[model samples]
Target chain A: MSWELTAADLPDLARGATLLGTGGGGDPYIGSKLVERVLGDGAITVLDPDELPDDAFVIPTAQMGAPTVMIEKIPAGTEPVLALRTLEEHLGRTADATMPIECGGINSMIPFVVAAETGLPVVDADGMGRAFPELSMETFAVYGVHGSPLALAGERGERVIIDTGDDDRQMERLARAVTIRLGGVGHIAEYAMSGADVKRTAVPRTISMALALGRAIRVAREQKRSPFEAIADTLAPTLYSHVRELFVGKVVDVDRRTTEGFARGLARIAPLDGGDELEIAFQNENLTARRGGELLAIVPDLICVVDHETAEPITTEGLRYGQRVRVLGISTPDLMRTPEALAAFGPAAFGLDETFRPVESR
Target chain B: MSWELTAADLPDLARGATLLGTGGGGDPYIGSKLVERVLGDGAITVLDPDELPDDAFVIPTAQMGAPTVMIEKIPAGTEPVLALRTLEEHLGRTADATMPIECGGINSMIPFVVAAETGLPVVDADGMGRAFPELSMETFAVYGVHGSPLALAGERGERVIIDTGDDDRQMERLARAVTIRLGGVGHIAEYAMSGADVKRTAVPRTISMALALGRAIRVAREQKRSPFEAIADTLAPTLYSHVRELFVGKVVDVDRRTTEGFARGLARIAPLDGGDELEIAFQNENLTARRGGELLAIVPDLICVVDHETAEPITTEGLRYGQRVRVLGISTPDLMRTPEALAAFGPAAFGLDETFRPVESR
Candidate 1:
């Protein structure tokens, strides 16, 4: 079904997208402001994958750099539009719609901004159901979509077009270097594809899923009920299943630094009652979680950290030394857990030693 | 006036270009091989700037990276062709001619390779009468030619186009970062301009000057005369005049390393009879020379090091300890010594503390 997203939907969308980010994808509050500024008194048509013609041309848009840097250097709100236009000019074709490259805080909202500016509808699907650091981590790249012929724009209106011709790793390497030189952040339009390709490769209805998850958490708070239970109930019917609260603890340590265009770090959470500690490691998005030397979840699954009481998602850059938090382990979709998808974004891909094991199995 | 450049001209051109390079611009021998392989039985048309039509499109081509890296990793000879083609496609116009961005070893020869492959005439001019480390340090940029919309290609056939509007420094920063990711060497086509702009801003007749200098040294050697005196005679009537041999010494120390895509180093040469030492500092191209605490020459002037007996120019990457050498200081063209040009390529721009004093004035 086609739906509409207005300024009023931003709060819920931001909250839900933050949860899906696992622990990265930049700050949601800033993304919300950028979207609201451009979306003034307007509604964007959100099309389901089935609603699009097979020949529809879609381009995925997102920001590429350290999330921590985005906090200091907020985008000028014109970057995504410039990036999209640059790509459109390069391709010599008008885009039928815009879509998110990943389901993450700012990345999910960026498409809506581009849609508002270009008057193009947005697809409710995304390449990654949740965020991962590198461009090649997406299902679109893992399956068949080319990530090159990518357009990147800086806040200063500087533009660059990269064409690596099917070398996705080279694209990531070159783009990261450019991003660092662009003052640690750049907006990108990449993975241009057809509607049929999207239908075959993307995780469908992720925006709708995020909306439902947001509403569930909001309603649970209103009824004075456990938001975690509401989250479990909300995701029970979705492709991401087997949600569980792994631990509730006070944050004891967070060691993070922005390096090579990524906010990479490790956080340790100690049980309030003095039980075993939970350690979460992240590169942009959380890649691994362990409790007392036992692996609870790894990448290709979701390891999210949230506020203990309010259930608000805390990004990797926002992790603090003394905050009460809850860690949640959720199983990814079967498509994302397959050997091919795992190889693209698994523990091993991020230089982790262990093989991927599903959250449900754990 | 116009001339033809065949494979027979490459050896002499390489020798003279290496001399003009001062101490950078990659290995001239490798560049000679690359141009020879491409030239085959064909001869490229070398046109003086006045020969170009007012509306002719000209693009300057060069290699951008550390000279040391190019020695171990010779180009596939296809990178410059790819770079020129990429830029031409971006501009939506066929190039009428190609020229050197600078008069330096490999850089001066790269346009010949591009011209041979593209069937484009080679302009007998260059942006820099001599080389500087950064892209913006060119007469073309100093005198109002735009350097953006630049195309770069690596040996792996990776292509990137950067458009920074009029921001030349940003173009250099971004291009350098990309070149590093391209494994320390990339061929670039930049400074796209009209024939009018080339005639107004470029150092004219540099190709002819290099050829004359090469022939002078060769004839002097055959007659058992002084090559240094022959060099002085060859340059006396050109825009670059006031040539003088500053020191004859044995190199006692060389502290050099390849960093951030540049060969940066300092060479200390002690007098043969145990007198004052001459110290030369270089970043890609030699920037400054001092003898016993007295400045002898600084950029926008040329400080070239040559074999004491053979007169073969040694690049910064080729500098070694315990080599006998003679340092020559030559005044640059009056066009390059203007306040604007000095501000672009002078000592302060290279992080030296002294103001630029021409070799003749010193």
Candidate 2:
């Protein structure tokens, strides 16, 4: 299915993206403003992957770095277009369509801004069904998409094009360092692929799915119903399986430090009624959720923290003590459950001792 | 004058470059070995800047990062050529000549290695007559050469090409971050200029000057004469004027740390015969020399530390407490004494309170 995304769709899109963000990908506020500014009278055309011509070149773009820094140093509003233009110049061809590298947080809105600015249709698909901390954790990488010949742009028109005979992990290391140098955040355009590869590798219809999820939350709030039940029902029939409420608690503590270009820390949430406390550890994005040493949900699964009363999602950087929140668990898609995907984004991949057991199994 | 650099010249070249290094540019051992390995039967043809065609593309290459890291993580013998090739590819033309960005320590030998490997003639000139810590301190930059459209390559075959609307300082910030990410050292080919710019801005005959200084020290050692005197005499007739012994003492204390991609610290030297102790501060290269708050030598004046007995120059990273050494002060070249040059490399530029006083004035 295809549709034109108008300004009215932005609120739901941003809200839904934050839910999928799982507490990372930066605050969607700046991204929302940027999209709203560029998207004035221009509407973004959303094309399903199958609708694109097989030979058309599809380029994925996103911002990479710390969310804390992004909140302070707003982009000069030129990086995304510059990054896209540079990549196109390097490739000697205009991108037939633009797509988000991931469907979470600010990244989900970035492609729309680029699409509106450049007059290019955005693909309905994304490299990741939900956010993963590192660039190599994308399903596109698992399916053999090289990350280099990548173009990165800073706020001041500083542009760098990298080509490395390195694996995705090395690419991430190099790009992360570049991001830190560019003042802790940079816009990047990578993983240029043909439409056929997009259909085969990407998580399709994630844009539409996020929109539907956002609409459900809005409807639930209007009807005075539980947003948690609304979200679980909204995700039940989708690619994400096994939706459930993990915990309802007040955040007791949050220990986070920005290191090596990532916000890494652990959050302790005490049960609102005084039962066992739940702890969630994160490196940019939520990695594992546990209660008293028993794993509730681990990486390769989704662990989202939302406001207890309003169901508004709080990013990792936005999480603070004393906030009452409800943590929701949702199983990742089958594409991310494969052995290669697990090896790249599983609990063990993040230094956790337990082998990854799907959220559905729990 | 034109000459061929041979294996027989490596020792003198390395030794002279070290003296000119003014306690930075990294250790020359690896560079010596690299040049030796690459220059086996092939000789490096050295050309005076004036002899080159006006339109000929001259590329200056060097390694940028912390000197301490260079001692442990040696390069994989491919970075210079790779950096050159990548730049050539980006510019769509082969470099007509290769030259050192500075005639200090390892950089002095890097061009020779590239020349031997690529069969391009090595220019007998450099951007700096002696070493200065940052990229903007180069004479080329002082004379209006942009450091961009620059290419950097790492040991792991990671290559990056940067083009910025940024000045040289911003370029250094970006490249330094890239070097640190590439395992603390990266070979960069930048400041691509025409032969006319080379003649107008470069420090001419620096390679030959280094060789003569090295030969003088070698001769002084053989004849049991003071190597310090020979070095002063050798530099007296060159662009560098007013050489004198600043202090002769044993190292009392040394404090250093690798921060922001540079080895920054200070060394305190106390007189063995009980006069006044001298203190020298450095950031990769020695920045100032003072005795009890009395300024003796400051950048862009060259401050070098050499073994008191053997007269062998020691870089900042090689300095250790308890080593007996002599500090020498030498005047910077006229090219580096200009208002623009001093603004970029003088004492005040390094955060010193006093205005720059040429070594000759002292």
The DockQ leader among the candidates is: 1
Across residues B181-221, which tens digit of lDDT does each residue of candidate 1 receive? 99999999999999999999999999888878877888899
- TM-score values for chain B across all models: 0.98, 0.98
Global lDDT scores for all candidate models = 0.89, 0.88
Model 2, position A214: C-alpha lDDT score: 85
Who wins the TM-score comparison? 1
- Residues A1-362, model 2: lDDT tens digits: 78999888888888899888898878776888899999987688999887988998989989988877888888888999899998888778889999999898889988988998889999999987888778878888888887788899998889888877547787788788888988898999999999999988899989988888888899899999988788888888888858878899999999999999888999999997887899999998899899996899988788999999979889887778899999988888899889988888888778889888887776
What are the runs in model 2 whose C-alpha is more than 4 Å off? none
The alpha-carbon RMSD over the true interface for every model, in angstroms, is 0.4, 1.2
How well does each candidate superpose onto the true structure, as a TM-score?
A: 0.99, 0.97
Please name the candidate that would achieve the greatest lDDT relative to the true structure. 1
**Model 2, TM vs. native:** 0.97
